[model samples]
Target: MAGVRKRYGGKRALDGFDLTVERGTVHGVLGPNGAGKTTAVRVMTTLLRHDEGLVRVAGHDVRDRGREVRRRIGLLGQHAALDEDLGGRQNLEMFGRLHHLGARRAGVRADELLERFGLMDTGRKAVKLYSGGMRRRLDLAASLITEPEVLFLDEPTTGLDPRGRAEVWGAVRSLVGGGTTVLLTTQYLEEADQLADRISVVDSGRGVAEGTPDELKARIGGDRIDVVLHDADRLADGAHALAHAAGTHAVSTDVDRRLLSAPVADRMTALTETVRALHARGIEARDIALRRPTLDEVFLQLTAARGAGRPGATERQEMPA
Candidate 1:
């Protein structure tokens, strides 16, 4: 996308947004609610036209070559679009036909998808009777009817239980295995961390950060060290000792919980040194652990920077779970 813009009166849905996804990789578009995520996908899939800038999908300009672009892409929106009155197999068959597959081929493809999605037994059951997970599986199967080279999944696992989310993740892995390029928009940070080859974090109406999960995480700092003391009264002492050992203002003490958390530039070596120092001071830790910062931490740091009255601030409010 180039200089893409969309407006609803005074509010801009997408403001000069741009994104580029490489082929045969899972590219995650992440953002909070009311960000341009949905709007960007809409423009890329030809569902909504951009007021400015060029949009392209699968090498076809979305505006001028919409039909060609549509033929190369399959889309699964945030909500499943299965017809409740139809059987799971029937829904896939109908989509196959819509993709221009003949009767015999469409039926065969539907059966194949049903088996692949582990819904062969329920293929004859009306989608209305299907559980949320099963319905989402069928919706995904329908989207794959044409076997398009590019797939657009917008929060495909939203509202799913853990098992359902796992099922979707499995399906995404399978798609990537088959060399299908996927453009996924999701609010789930873990989902993006687990599946995406590269991530582009969008907020408000523009891309805020883009990189691999590890690279993004590394931007915030390094490993974290947490120590729990036997007595709450020792928290302040532990904080001071740990902070002194770490050579940085890395300590945060929780008096009630008797916990001290400190950022260690090198946790493996620093943590052991801190533990030895505490022991020498006659302090005993009930528990201790070293951990890498998660994507959530990185996101917060980046968004917080933008929120601090920085130039080009566009981070939006967090998305609803």
Candidate 2:
């Protein structure tokens, strides 16, 4: 999308938004509430109209060729879109038929998808009888009935348990492995960390940052040097020592648990310096380690910048489950 703009009354949902996704990759889109993530996806998937700008999917313009765009893309929304009363195979076959496949072909495709998604054993069981993970898998299979080139997943694992989320995550990996380009919008940062080859951070209806997960994390800050003090009383002394070692006053200390954290550009050098400084100051450390910033941190930094700049910015709400 280029210069895409959509407004609800006076509020702008997308302001000069832009995103470029290469084929056969998992591209994750992330943002806090009301950041225009859902709007961008709706425009790209032809579910909503953009007031202005360019949107092309699978080489077709989304504006004039929405039907063609729909034909090439599959959307698995936040909730499972399945007939709970129908068996897994019946549900898939029904979807295939809706995609214009003949009855014989639909039955054959149902068997293939059932086997592919590991639902063959429960193919004849009603969807309501299936577990949460199984129902989601069936929903995914239904979306794939037409063999789409691009797939759109909007918070695909929102309410699932850990085991259920893992099942869906594994299925997503399998799709990308088989050369399907997936655009995922998720509230859970870890989901994006595990799935996305690249991520776009959106805020205030604009694309604020876009890069690989590691690249984005590097933008906010680098590896951190954390020292867990042996004594709670030494927290102040440890912070001062760490600040001296890190050459920055931006040291954070937790008094109750006695944890001191500081930003470090050079991991080994900082670690060595902090260790020596602690020894010289008669401070005992229970643990000292260097670790990278998490995706959650990146999300906060990006969205915080936007919210700070515009206090009353309109927020987005996901379509109710």
Candidate 3:
């Protein structure tokens, strides 16, 4: 997408949104609520047209080559769109027919999908009788009926339990392994970190940050060293020692439990010095670990800067429609 914009009356849903998804890779679209992630997916999937900008899916122009684009792509919307009255197998067969596949081929494909998605035993059961995870898997299977080259998944695992989410993740990994290009829009940070090769964070209808999970985390700052002391009275002492050793105010002390967080530019040196300092003061730490910044931390840092009216605030200027 290039300079994409969409409006619901005067309020813009997407503001000059631009995203580039390379072929055969999982590109994660991440954002907080109402960040235009859904709107962007709709435009890319050709379900909704952008007021401005060029969108190409599978090398077919979304505007000028709607049919070609649709043929090459599959979509699983935020909500499950399944025929409640129809059996799972029947629904798959119906979609396959709509895609113009032969009856025999459609039946075979439906059965294969049922097994692959762990729905084979329940294929004969009505969709309304299926569980939430079953319904989600069925929706995903429906999207793959056409064997699309490009897949658009909008918050695919929203209501799933841990096991169900894992199943979906496995299916996604299999798709990518077979060289399918995926555009995933998810509010779950761990989902993006686990699956996406690159992530683009959107906020308030604009791109705030874009990079691999590690790259974005690195941009925020250095490693975080967290120490948990045995006694609450050692909290202040731990904080002071960590601050003097780390050369930054990146320390947070919890008096109740004697927990301290210190930012370390160099983990090895910081850990060594912190251990020595704690030992010298007879402060016994129950636990200590150096943690890299999480995607959530990176997102908070980047979006916080934007909210603070920092420099490059409008670096991604909204293009005129």
The worst-scoring run of ten residues by lDDT in candidate 1 lies at 312-321
Q: Relative to the true structure, how large is the alpha-carbon lDDT of every model?
A: 0.85, 0.90, 0.85
Q: Tens-digit lDDT track for model 3 on 1-321?
A: 888888766667777888999899999998766678887887888777789888888999999999999999999987888899999999999999989998999999999899888899999999999887788889999999989999999999998888778878988998899899999988788899999999999876778789888998889777988899888877888888878877788788877766898778889998888888888888889998999988888878777655543322221232223
Which 10 consecutive positions of candidate 3 have the poorest summed lDDT? 311-320
Query: Candidate 1, residues 1-321: lDDT per residue as tens digits?
Result: 878888655667777888889999999998766777887888898887778998888889998999999999999998888889999999998988887899999999999999988999999999999988898888988989999999999999999998898988998899899999999999899999999999998766778899999889878777888889997777777888888777678587887778888888876788778888798788889999898889888777766655543323222322212
| TM-scores of the models, in the order given | 0.92, 0.94, 0.90
**lDDT value for model 2:** 0.90
Ranking by TM-score: 2, 1, 3
**lDDT for residue 251 in candidate 1, whole number 0-100:** 82
The digit string of per-residue lDDT tens for model 2 on 76-147 reads: 987788999999999999999988999999999999999989999999999999989888989998999988
Model 2: lDDT of residue 196:
99
Model 3, stretches more than 4 Å misplaced?
Answer: 254-257, 307-321
- In candidate 2, position 90 carries an lDDT of 96
lDDT agreement of model 1 with the native: 0.85
